[model samples]
Target: MSVPAADRGATTVAERAVRRIAERAATEALPPGEVLAARGAAAVRGRRARVSVAVTLPYPTVLDDAGERVRSHVADRTAGLTGLVVPSARVRVRALRVREPKQGAEAAAPVARAGRGRSGAGRPWSQRRVPAAVSAFGCAAVCGAFLYDVVRVHAVGRPPARWRARLMEWLVTHGPDSGVWPGLVSAGAVFLLGVWLLVLALTPGRRRLLPMAAPAEGVRAVLDRRAVSALLRDAVAEVPGITRVRVRVGRRGARVRARLGFGGLESARRAVTEACEEALGACGLARPSRLRARVRTDPLWRAPTPPGANTGSGPAGSPASPSPTPDATTATTATTATTATTATTQGSSRA
Candidate 1:
């Protein structure tokens, strides 16, 4: 007999208690003390001395409740056939929910803002200041070490004052004698300028760098693994409509490769391209030569159209009729003029 939902123990405390008792009894009948937990187990007595057990469930897909129930029921029934006296019980449920979907979503939502504030607002400022400080400290340390090395060289190995005089004489003779000191100073200046340029070239930009290419070409950039992963996290969080984003960032150029998922291929491509750029830019990466964003459409994300939708009623077709094309409008005007002339001729003929 079909159990009406209203009569199936939801309406009254007495009925619910009875159902709960029957559920526990039926559950106990099938291999008790096994430490299996039921999310929402209930029981009811059936006619012909049988009990019914139903449970809402949760877990790995391999441990799906439906398959488990089927296997357990079969084993118990087989045992009954072997005279194991498996109680004439039934376990029936339309659906099993291991855990409710809505329960923990709220708890997770606030974490995003907290994380953003910590990293975006707080960490970046610290990162910017700390790196500059470290660089400045490094420069000072280098200068101090160089001065110490010069002093050590002077203290440890001084050829007689005669050697110094000979070296000076060689410079006076072979080098630009009049401007030798200035030339030496200029060379040192050039060396320092080259070192400065090299350092500037190596440092990352203050803004995030996204090196994305057109969809037709693939994206390539050298990036830190952590920076790319952070970008991917942000893309996943901020874009609600996107279904999936796959990001790969390489070292050196911060080369970015991404596969984005959306309801449609076009939208997916667009989102991936935009997200890749934003992520790279945020990390202060320069665009790479091979930056590309590939967009993939997920079959599951296809939007369902209302049944019996009119496909032809888009921009091309309208209930009000198409506006006349330039040629068509000219032809129409010519036809009207011809008709007017014909009417005048007819009137003249009648006269």
Candidate 2:
């Protein structure tokens, strides 16, 4: 094979330059900033080529007490020095050159420190105000409704007879009553209101009890098993041709079995199967694959009326509908026997 001229040149200039730089970096233990500058200079002059570059090791920070500790020591020593900023600079181990530190290095450090550090004092208007406003408006509306109810019952109308009569009689018969009961009742009412308001304030999402609006994530309500089962039964009953319906909940999900009771096995299976599929479709599951149906057993199938028992018909009743092919019968029998055995073993274990 012939060698390419470009490959020959790469070996001569780029390979030797990279080797020299790596050797110098290893020997001098040069700081990362100087090393980076050297690498940049190499690329500009076409002395070396880097196909892949990544920091294999991280230098220590002031917060970190382990590692070689030399990086931090160097950073601290050079923090206030002139012409280069070293504290924030990472220790990159590539190419190397040494130049005298510049005159502005010390000033550069503090300015870089202030400019680079993160501060949470001011965020964008959307984050700071929108969520807070939404939560506040929701809470206020709930409180306003409760307060309106209170005012409507007490301050705006004639008080109910029992309490009103007693209060009036007491005020007329006994001049200005004095007791702790009223004060205690007032305090309890205030405490209850405060507790309720606090709960409303801390609660998330919009309040549905009163009319106010805010963008809400989602609304949820509890649908207990009894409610779900009742709904399923009602829906199935409405299917025009279905009778003799049965539902069973199993580990695999839910199994609904139904049959037309009076129809042929095939017809009953068709109607019940379609109804089940339609009912499940309305539930909107993640995928159609999640829902399935099968006709286990239908009571409507009859043993084909004995051959020649009826007045001459077209086929005179074929022999019990031709007992399923021998292979099919054997396979079915084996499956049933296996299933029964497994169930028996499981039941014995439970017992």
Reference-based TM-score of each model: 0.23, 0.22
Residues 204-283, model 1: lDDT tens digits: 55434333222111223434456676766567446545654555555433333433333445655566667666765566
Best candidate, TM-score: 1
Point out the worst 10-residue segment of candidate 1 by lDDT: 117-126
- Residue 129's lDDT in candidate 1: 58
lDDT of 1: 0.50
Instruction: Report the number of the highest-lDDT candidate.
Output: 1
Q: lDDT, candidate 1, residue 221?
A: 43
Worst 10 residues of 2 by lDDT: 207-216
